[model samples]
Target: MGSTSSGRSTGARDRDGEGRARNARPRDGLGRPLPYEAQGVARQPEGIVRTPEQSVAEAQGLLDAGRPFHAHEVFEDAWKSGPQEERELWRGLAQVAVGLTHAARGNVTGGARLLRRGAGGVEQWAAQSGRQRPYGMDLVGLVAWGRGLADDVEAGGGTVDAQARAPRLRGQVP
Candidate 1:
């Protein structure tokens, strides 16, 4: 259910015709915003726009769908476009996806280290952004789960408890 059939259609229509109708913003086939339009951060001369929030949400959706490597790539692309303030935040998030990707592959030690670095960077970025930090399950929760996995690996733990964890945490494994 990560992908919706109407996403592209709605996004295109929203971009090409009705711009002021929706609050959720338009998205591309990949679920990322087209640029400048989604957030309505700035006015443009009539074209598609994608916002950081949309891009992050798309990446999060991919991560939730068991695609952290893809999520890492998406966030990396978003990060490369510099706004100075949000740039580092995207970078940290991209790293978080990478860390989660590693953890999913059972590389516990590497995942833990990357998670630590990402956590530090994202926490700083979140504070600076002054935006309520993204939902904890996305990044913070991943770091904790990665840590738990690392601890389990160190102590020779068993399979992670799917039922015991939240849905968002599921992204950490796959």
Candidate 2:
């Protein structure tokens, strides 16, 4: 009864009991919304608190699996729950994941811009905090990776293989 002429639901959007909008829509690997009836990759739950090590591990796995959007969500959780001093680190990592998602999804301009922005944010945070390898992350390597991927995406003007371009969260310093 809540369906529109197109046979899609037309009432209030899916929501939790608290009345907050919940997107029940399925999503592709890149996090693009799919039709309600279409199957989707499992979504990472929101707002869970995890230790820095756990966050890094989980996000790295997702990135390596070519699920950068999921990796972004994992980083988002850390950004929201981590200590104030580490918020920028997590936020920047999330942005880098999303940048990869954009590049994989064929948004070349947006992908390149976000990659650079995220790399710059990470670099700035490391300079300000002087914790280049917090929680075993190789900030310098990740920044260089993100920036280099951005350059490649821009030059190609096309989609990229997200897994192939995924950055190693832990890598040799320098």
Candidate 3:
């Protein structure tokens, strides 16, 4: 209910005001708002900043190195930070990693289910994002391969053939 010098009731103080919200924290050294600043900045948590393509590249490296679990963790981190519109793609990638981990552990049924779920996620992303085409070489591709392997297993077939053809899940590119 306080009025500013211009005779306007300023519900909140501006940056120059010493009587600003007590909970407000100072700006950081970079002249940006501090991490805990409660006011003067929108509270929306920033999403992971890296592009999905970058995530894919990193995940591929992990796959090449035979580190499905690590790749899954990366995808999960990306998925959490990706925009809402692209969250599914990251999740799909992570799911595929999980599927691969299960396969490596000899949990065929679990792997199959995870792969199918990943495929569904990527397929949905494709429909929503309108990328290359049906099962393009991206999240969609990862998911499609997972689904294919899952289906192969369900049909009493050796899914290793599909795994062999699947894009590398991780590796350190020399």
Best candidate according to lDDT: 2
Backbone collision count in every prediction?
A: 5, 0, 12
Compare candidates 1 and 3 on lDDT and give the better one.
3
TM-score ranking, best first: 2, 3, 1
Identify the leading candidate in terms of TM-score.
2
lDDT per residue (tens digit) for residues 13-102 in model 3 = 444255544424443211235534234322212234556666677666666655565667677878898678878877887887777666
The sequence of per-residue lDDT tens digits that candidate 2 reaches over residues 25-60 is 899998999988889999999989999999999999
Query: What lDDT does the true structure give each of the candidates?
Result: 0.55, 0.92, 0.61
How much does each candidate deviate from the true structure in C-alpha RMSD?
12.6, 2.3, 14.3
Which runs of model 3 end up more than 4 angstroms from their true locations? 1-49, 133-136, 154-174
Candidate 3 is scored at a TM of: 0.58
For residues 13-119, write the lDDT of model 1, one tens digit per residue.
33234455543454332233444344432211222234766665666667566666567777677777647677777777777667666665566666656656766
Model 1 earns a TM-score of 0.53
Q: How much is 114 displaced in model 3, in angstroms?
A: 0.2
